[model samples]
Target chain A: MSDSRVSSVIQEWAYSSQAHTQTLNPTTTNHAGSTSQLTQMDMIPYSQSQGLVRGGTDDRVTEQMMGLSYLPYTSSSCLSNSSSTGTTNHHQGHPNTQQDFSSFLLPSLRAPVNKRSISKDSAEYRLRRERNNIAVRKSRDKARRRILLTQQRAQHLQEENQKLQMRIGQLTQELDTLKHILSQRHLHGAEEGVAGESNI
Target chain B: MSDSRVSSVIQEWAYSSQAHTQTLNPTTTNHAGSTSQLTQMDMIPYSQSQGLVRGGTDDRVTEQMMGLSYLPYTSSSCLSNSSSTGTTNHHQGHPNTQQDFSSFLLPSLRAPVNKRSISKDSAEYRLRRERNNIAVRKSRDKARRRILLTQQRAQHLQEENQKLQMRIGQLTQELDTLKHILSQRHLHGAEEGVAGESNI
Candidate 1:
């Protein structure tokens, strides 16, 4: 791929991360709680205003890649339901919201468009869409889980590290105390002089 | 936002994750270690063959988002030089090769296509491309660092955890020995029994 083109796409990613009234649906909880087509429809105009028609068949592919075209984002977004107002709630629910739009959506690849205007209504395209729908959900669920797991592992490790450091500290202190007592008695050899330390 | 459309994009993501001869550029080292428009052109036919013309001005945006548009991929792909044959090298160097093209490139959201036929040669598009190129590189570098840091932290924690466990074992053993000696003495005192169990 041309570096120039990648930059253009990333630029759109950067653009998408911003809270543009013309660009975003701006729902974290709303989208997740929303099981209706109405919620999807509500978000369409905003996505369409950005340039790609959310309703358009070709662009719908792009929408999925964005991770924004669909409703009911699980876990982080869906779990938290706050505010009737929009943009603020987006940040409130998901920490990786920018990553979802920018990093996650980074690849907005269009399969070499030899057939750019391929009939979206075609049976093959519909089949691809259905398969993709399943795949994306599975893929996203997997993605979300992996990220959460990584974060949890990191947290667990940090706590373990601190506990280890504390243990090391305790061991060193014990060794020092043993040395001090032996030194006061002018004793040599740890095995004999500090046979059991404080263990009787 | 339609589940069907999102699935379609993710299905492409799955497809992209695979080693499709026609669909992929199949370069990890080749793209990064070398630098030239010629190399970019060389990969064009493969990417072009993916049904989206790599040579097309309009489709270049999608190509960028796919994380496949550019000549040079830094770090994980660039650092290792293992294979001369194409597809093998892609997997050989980058562990997250699929993540790069699939998850990292996941967003692929297009600006709503109001002006679908935006002139590529136009100064505006050119500027956007230039800015995006810088942003993408920076963004990717940040992402790589984050993932690496997380992995490193987990490894470090595991090692620390083992060491802490060992220390706890030692401390417990010393405490047990102290108790045994105290029991042998048959002298039951509150503070004297367990005081400084292993600290001399």
Candidate 2:
């Protein structure tokens, strides 16, 4: 295809993809959404169109939306006209560009439902940056969990130490009493021996 | 004082302490009726002698008598002969020997009530050892407590993370729904726009 023709095709695809994204954004707001209405409407047609666009699910749409927002475009409305058009010719007919586009959209499509978020592709530089933010948040949560566990263990040990000390004190007191009785018994025996000597 | 003098003093004290101790023994199985009564009366004189020898109370006399069993003697009956001979010029004065005597007698005087059984000393030793053991136990308890707390905190964080995930999912769904509605509205607008243009 001619360069101009390829550019037009790319623009048309991008616009349709954007439109589809707008349609899906509300559904992906919650992982548990009633997509039965849309799903029931026409499964085949929707899936077919889904196959055409890189991001078929609403989650992907949000990821991509956030990804798009991170782009250098100061104005959200003018992104396609300025940046999209400028980068169009460079990616045309490039295998790497196609791969990048697929990578950018596939993660959002297949990301764990609980942790749904965008992953960036080489070409989807704007989306890739957004994915980094999510990764950072996950690590911080893990560290906080570790610190909390450490503190609890310390408190438990202190309580146990105190109980053991009380037990030792009680044992010492009993020992002392036993020793006292033994001494008194010895003295009585001595007196009897002396009295026997006096009788002799 | 000289070593021999110290030894003699210790021996004399031990011998005297031992004689008085036999008179005070409570577990005499002697069936001699008059001898038993005489033995009991003799204990008061013996006690006074012990008080003169060490210048201490009955409690101290008892403490020393109990300490004797841990020594080499079999019976308190040998105390009379042992006293005069033990205190001869043999041990006149030695600080180390004196210290030894002091240590042996100190417990009885200082802790008179502790003369229950050999367990009294053992209990004291055990208490010391236990105190050390508690230090170790405390550390372990601390570690365990820390782990429990960590687990609890992690559970709390997990709950929060789950809630946030749920919220994110809901927001995604809402966004998707909104986008779907917008698309329907826009599609309707586009259809109306086309009809109007065709008429014009």
| TM-score of every prediction relative to native | 0.33, 0.20
Best-performing candidate as measured by DockQ: 1
- Write down the C-alpha DockQ for each prediction: 0.07, 0.01
Model 1 stretches with alpha carbons more than 4 Å out: A1-121, A171-200, B1-121, B178-200
**What is the lDDT of every predicted structure here?**
0.38, 0.32
Docking class of 1: incorrect
User: Per-residue lDDT tens digits of candidate 1, residues A76-102?
Assistant: 211221221111222233222444244
Q: How does model 1 score on DockQ?
A: 0.07
Q: Taking the tens digit of each residue's C-alpha lDDT, what string does model 2 give over B105-165? A: 6543322332343231244544544455446544533433333333344334444454555
What local lDDT score does residue B114 receive in model 2, on the 0 to 100 scale?
Answer: 24
Give me the displacement of residue A187 in model 1, in angstroms: 9.8
